[model samples]
Target: MSLDTTTAMPTNGRPIPDPVPNDLTLPQSVDVVVIGAGIAGVCTALELAERGLKVALCEKGDVGAEQSSRNWGWVRLSHRDPREMPLMVESVRLWKGMNERTGAETGYRQCGITFSVTTDEALKEEEDWAQILQEYQIPARVLPAPEALNAFPGLTAPIKGALYNPHDGRAEPQKASPAIANAFRMLGGTVHQNCAVRTVETSGGKVSAVVTENGTIRCSSVVVAAGIWSRLFLGNLGIDLPMLKTTGTVLRTDPVPDGPEGTFKFQDYTFRRRLDGGYSISGPQTGLYEITPDSFWLAPKFFPALKSEFTRLKFRFGKRFVQEMKLPRKWGATDRTPFEDTRIYDPQPDTKAIDKVYAQLQAAYPAFQGVGIAQRWAGYIDVMPDIIPVVSSTEGVRGHIPGLFVASGLSGHGFGLGPGIGKLMADLVTGAVPVVDPSQYRLSRFSDGSKIAPMEGILRR
Candidate 1:
């Protein structure tokens, strides 16, 4: 099948009004230059600006135009990787107070999250994951069959049990990064849209400045939060970042009352009630992994992860292979890069998979039988080998690029973990004490002979 490479701005379920305008003049110098205007970049800039540091956030396109807004908008911690639990714990706290801090409506609400299981084996998995939650003192409970059915009504299937996290929540992906960017501007931070950073300029083996498509911006430090483009950007610097992309398709329905209040994941279908009174739905175990040149090159490193997720991921080959082959990996600052060609990475939705999910949803809940599909869209998720994120500095890592930090490769958890990861990146960039231990997220784990693997649990998005 031919891939749809249409270069249009992503339709993020809801319309984002009154975007923060870009700074007309790029500052000659700033304390830090953050690449990519996704949630991670915006939040990092906000934290740094609040610390009285001059920071500039440069994006290839509009803020949150990519996976930041294209996600399922779930802010959950019920089934997190144990290594990321602490950071997620802190992230939920940050999310609760985000509206007051940013003075913007992020649409965050703690309506709770439910992972419904049908089989005895699946129930055991949730129970085991709940033990990890208990270790971290998280208040997630596993409801038995009868109680689970009572907690979530309209379920026609026989649910053995469910893992419930009352503190877990949902946020509007459409409004999150933009609101954070506006908040960053309020704190005296610079935001540059349509500005693609070609490469980082090094001075004495440290980041000195960045050459964007608009112009050069001198800075002492740089944070690479470029979501799917981080690997390519770092590749030009001779740094091998083991990152890959997977396409996630989602659809939203018109305002349909009588739906479940919180986010829910059944055997195959997953959904969350939108603030707009509609429901955002997708398949819990469905996504496409378009085979690219990187697939072969990074296969060895991603072997464990591939085996772990073999049941969920589907492999395909087509235009994505050719498009990635045509992407200029080692571009000079003067050359027009692919980032400029595709301002926003809006992939076509998997209509077949979406139809299957919608059918399953209606079959499970008769209330949704008449729900009308309002919109459907897809985005690429920047996945790391271990299916976790790397939020670390380059101080002691191999390649040891000083004055540089990265908070990318969030797998699919960037939206929920953005704020906490941003705070951690700020702490690393400013040489302040970090909020969580940063050893697990070091970039060298892939190269240092550490066994890279995903934690045992149902993958949550």
Candidate 2:
């Protein structure tokens, strides 16, 4: 099948990529039932299937329909929370080989990334983080003022310095997960789209099987990489995963030649060179926080996270509050779930915010002056208190639910971190040695006495 998504925006109105045909026949048994076909779930299933495990990959919507395909697509290692450095290093390695492994166009390019700092305080913060990277033996350096300004062509912004990592990269979000999922299918794995797993049926405090909308799938274990819907899914299993959702608006411009060599970030906005010659632009810190029921419910737990992200966020309380307020917390297997009702969690786009960021991009870089926006979109990014992901077993903390694993609360960095988390989760499920240390990503950090905090100065994803 010819893949033609040139005009598709992966938003609500436009058609997203669906290269991976749905596997309608649900198998009676599989060694693992991987829930949610976003990057996390799809990559995890691909890893397990490659390891000779019978895996069933299930999704409430098409693969990469939600945040997976709707992100800024910056596969960077700069300014990451120190805890994620190891996994990010692994992710970069996996990304380097993703196209070769899948035999598909993932648009993975090691074009480098620059976290530009226009203020002295920001430069100092960037220097501190660069030191952390140095300690980790990661090649990240803070460039001086003139060096930073000269690095990005057609630049007019007075940037003091920047933390640059040449090994960082970018990828096409619309193609990554689907390519990996197609590779999984070619390997004889099964995929079920529009399949909402209502709950995991447990036996003797351990997971026995997963009951989906279509039928039951008997599996030894289940991995929930359900993205924004993970908290709700876990709530049904009597497990609580504290999460808050933020809306990030993004737009792609018409192809502009010689804008910049790679991805560049300013305080107000971020722009990356896309594989299509166009640039994906968005406000990095201008994430709009839509008030929901979870905001108040998880306030105490998320207070510190909010404090760090407060300056970069804009708040609004409207219909989304009511929409989330009415969602049922618990539901039976046969009953209809919020997941089935909303296959694509495409929220309303904040065009005004996006337009403001676009104006800034044009002012800083002259190449974007006359570029027309090809498409504009938005997505709800789930965030944990630590602004990182929880890629651990359910039994890690309280043994509340055995035979279950979670890879959620990725904040806005899920797209870049997906493959590494997928590989890590697969290792945990099979009882194999992990690719990186998983202690920082444990779900028990909230309940346990671990000092829950974001990396230096509490940065947002």
State TM-scores per candidate. 0.94, 0.95
Candidate 2 — which residues are off by over 4 angstroms? Answer: 1-15, 396-399
lDDT of 2 at 412: 78
- Kindly list the per-residue Cα lDDT of model 1 for residues 326-353, writing each as its tens digit: 8888988898988899888778788778
**lDDT values for all models:** 0.85, 0.85
Model 1 lDDT at residue 50: 93
Clash pairs detected, candidate 2: none
Of candidate 2, the 10-residue stretch with the lowest lDDT total is 1-10
